[model samples]
Target: MALPVASPVVIRFGRLGDTVLLAPLLRKLHQRYGTPCRLVSLGECARTLYQGSADVAQVHWFASQHGWLWTNPRRLAVALALRSMREAPFYICEPDVRTRTKVRPMLALAGIAAEHCVFIEDIPLGEGEHWADWLLRFADLTPAAFAATPALDASRQLRAPSIRATPDELAEARAWLAAQGVDAAQPLVLLQPANKRTMRWNGVRAADDDDKSWPVSRWAKLASAILQWQPDAHVLLCGCAAEAGYLASIRAEAGLPRLLAPTGGLPLGLLRGLMELAHSMVSVDTGPAHLAAATGCPLVVLFGHRWPSMWVPRSASGSAVTVLGGLPHTPRVDQIGVEEVAQAWWRLPPRPVDIVPAAMGERRARVA
Candidate 1:
């Protein structure tokens, strides 16, 4: 069945990983509906993450969800813009009850009928299905608010989520790495030692905060281990400029020349670009760790009690990914040891020959 000529709209407030996961549904919808989607996303990265992709028609982004319904002018403006496209079918991916409450009135204010919207909370997910798969399946679910919803795109099955980085973006990444004196001839190993909360607090610990971080000292130790086995390996400490001092301190703690921290953090596009060529990445569970998985970079990711499988970003590209934590026994990522992480990295399967550059090969390459 074909959709109406109206462009589809999707609502998801997501980070790099979420956006990466969102790609498949967008791809399916774009193919089925024959139009790109208008995305209502949150924060700086969601907008940045989809810059190179054709699936997103326009990105309506705001700083944060704080006071979004009343005080956020950007949110208000987006509602007004959607008012003009009132006929377009809107898919609400957010499952939070409070969020739905805020969204309902805003859409009503824009003169959108309840029948025109689809919400994911309408039903329970099938057993052992990935959230991305659940999202793909939920689009076809007709909301009780609407009579018979148009059968959404389900013909095209996305094996895994994939984000496309532009060729120009790849070139820029190479230039940036080369400028950083990153010798592309040798293996480029990335250590994404910081997650959003870790960087947000500048690695600080506070009461009532959820944490999924490996110790910086462990990160420092991991860097040394990489150089110990693979002397020529360039271990890039990944973080934003705000986390520069923190990453630098890790580099200093490691006390090794191979470990280098970029003065600037790896931006979303550049990070994707580099991941395509990177030998591997090791990190605590975070959005970029998901991004690495999507890009097909071999990964060793630490985890916590949260997101046993639902939030786990399995490699869409079928890249090797090693997970090291979960519920019952391993409550926090910090409980995972440095030696285990190092051994996991050692155990990661080699990058498939097709994705490898001419100069890129085995991880055991050593400097003379």
Candidate 2:
């Protein structure tokens, strides 16, 4: 018998990393309802998170509204589109109360009934609470359904496939590196010195605390250390063009060879593909860290204020060492010193030979 068609459920999550973290809950919703669920996302980043996922039937970009009614025709068009679809049960998934309060009225104005909405707030749990499991509770799933073990197991299978770089792209990248006398085949370590705009803490004004970023100097130190371990190991610095000058400064101070920032000027898809080819990735709590997780690349994630339990990758094999020693939700990377991050890197197990190599040579690559 066909399952009863309920109102369409819509999830409103803005950030890319948050959406990735919420994948398990979305999966559970799809399993339970087996209905076409729509996602109302904020921008390009959120759209990328849902890419290649079976859970989301369609994604609508949320536009700014001037009044209670959607002044933006695009939003009205989306509402009309939703109305055109079957009048299934509609649900708004919000894990935070503040966001729920802010978006609830807006959703209501868009015609979502209050009764159909659900909020999953900060509920207490015993030791080793899996947040993904906790999120399923809002959907009427039992504790068994909320179990993390199965979720983690499923994550392993759903890991994103490596973005395959075309021959022309590879040739161009290699030729550019070669012209600069950089070894194209050597093991390369990519360092992302900056987090996404939303994740960075601008610093506290109390105690005369000065604003700072996770020191670029620390990355220079790590790059030198990696090269000491493997003399052929080259360092590539990657980020937006605005970050290129910082990379240049770091390169000059460290006096190390610098490869082109693949992230600069490249489309999001291409950059992700190049990241898949790296030996290992080290990033502060950011979008690149989440992207690295999707590639199944071994990652050393430095955390200051965020809860690692709630945000860390689900794969057991993919290790995350978070230096969270402060009040919850207040991630201060300054509190996490260079030595602490170094220790985390030291603790990371050596990359398995079965994993993808920095240079895609004759070696057989592992299934990502």
Candidate 3:
């Protein structure tokens, strides 16, 4: 019997950050077809991309066994399951050169014929094109929907475990602060000091010594300066628990107010809420920077290899500025000096006392 035709779309990237980066384009696909799209994903990123969107109706995991029939039972099981379910014309979207080679054979073994497969290689590299925009060129869709600002829809909203901090979670965060003898009344400034591998490849490369983050001594200096400018302002160091030592180093150097690593670990929703609550955020070109943009927080981002015009935050209500170095390859940490970062922060428009405050306060109240 012939199976029902499914709107076939496969994004083969394995990183959560990349999946989030591609979300706008995915939303565009949903808008254009008004059909639920299927996702073929692997690893932790499955959680990030499949946020229960009406558009993303189903998700299939990539099977690992390809060389031998019975070598890996799990891989075979996944493949057989997908085959028995249905077969449809499949499109493979590869935005990165590295992923293209890795994902080709995997798709082929899953009963996706070569003729039905579409490889993306035509997207041009330019000064002002976002990574999202560059990826969207692969799909048979218009750029208008891709360029359209994303609204806070059901899919985009952070689910309970990811970003939405529960009442218990919020109480825990406050309790932790109190235990440390730190005050929570003061507005929080979030500092995300690490950069992921792709971001490093395109922009800031990792430091050779101990695989530590880009020398955020400059960021520490700037944090101190912000506090000097506003003594009551408190800074919160945020990242995975694995980043706790790095946070400790920054805290020692900068004398930052409270260093809070999510004890239960940061789910995407809580991280978004943290960004939304922050008065501002200073980060390297990383996933947190992208997540921060979704919160409409005032952001000053430092761009190294990537162009600011293409990837800078795109919120209508908030202010954001990106400082870019004029280098084609990843910009060295030293190239982006503290003065440049401070200058960008200085340029942020002052938050309006009445209207803006009311809107933000309302959002906080709702979250509370």
lDDT of each: 0.75, 0.54, 0.55
Best by lDDT: 1
What are the per-residue Cα lDDT tens digits for candidate 3 across 158-216? 21112223344445545554664655555666777765452332444446521224575
Across 57-166, the per-residue lDDT of candidate 2 in tens digits comes to 66776554334435667655555555443335455556566665645555555565444445555344434555545555554522322233122234333232232234
Q: Candidate 1 lDDT, tens digit per residue, 1-368?
A: 23343667888876767777887778766765667877887777767667766777778777667685668788788778778767777888887888777677678778987777888888667766678888887656544554443565444567476664667777887888788787777788899977777755445544135557677789999999988888877888887777787788888898888788877777777888888778899987788888888777888988886655776767766778888887657878888888999999988987655655445554434331
Between prediction 1 and prediction 2, which has the larger lDDT? 1
**What's model 2's lDDT at 102?**
49
lDDT of 2 at 161: 21
Cα displacement (Å) at residue 333, model 2? 2.3
| Candidate 1 off by > 4 Å | 1-5, 68-70, 125-128, 143-155, 200-203, 206-210, 357-368
Off by over 4 Å in 2: 1-8, 63-80, 122-131, 141-184, 197-212, 262-267, 316-331, 337-340, 350-368
All candidates: CA RMSD in angstroms?
3.5, 6.4, 7.4
Find the 10 residues in a row with the least total lDDT in model 3: 157-166
TM-score of each: 0.89, 0.71, 0.71
* Stretches > 4 Å off in candidate 3: 1-4, 49-54, 59-89, 96-98, 122-128, 141-185, 197-213, 259-265, 309-319, 326-330, 350-368
Greater TM-score among 1 and 3 belongs to: 1
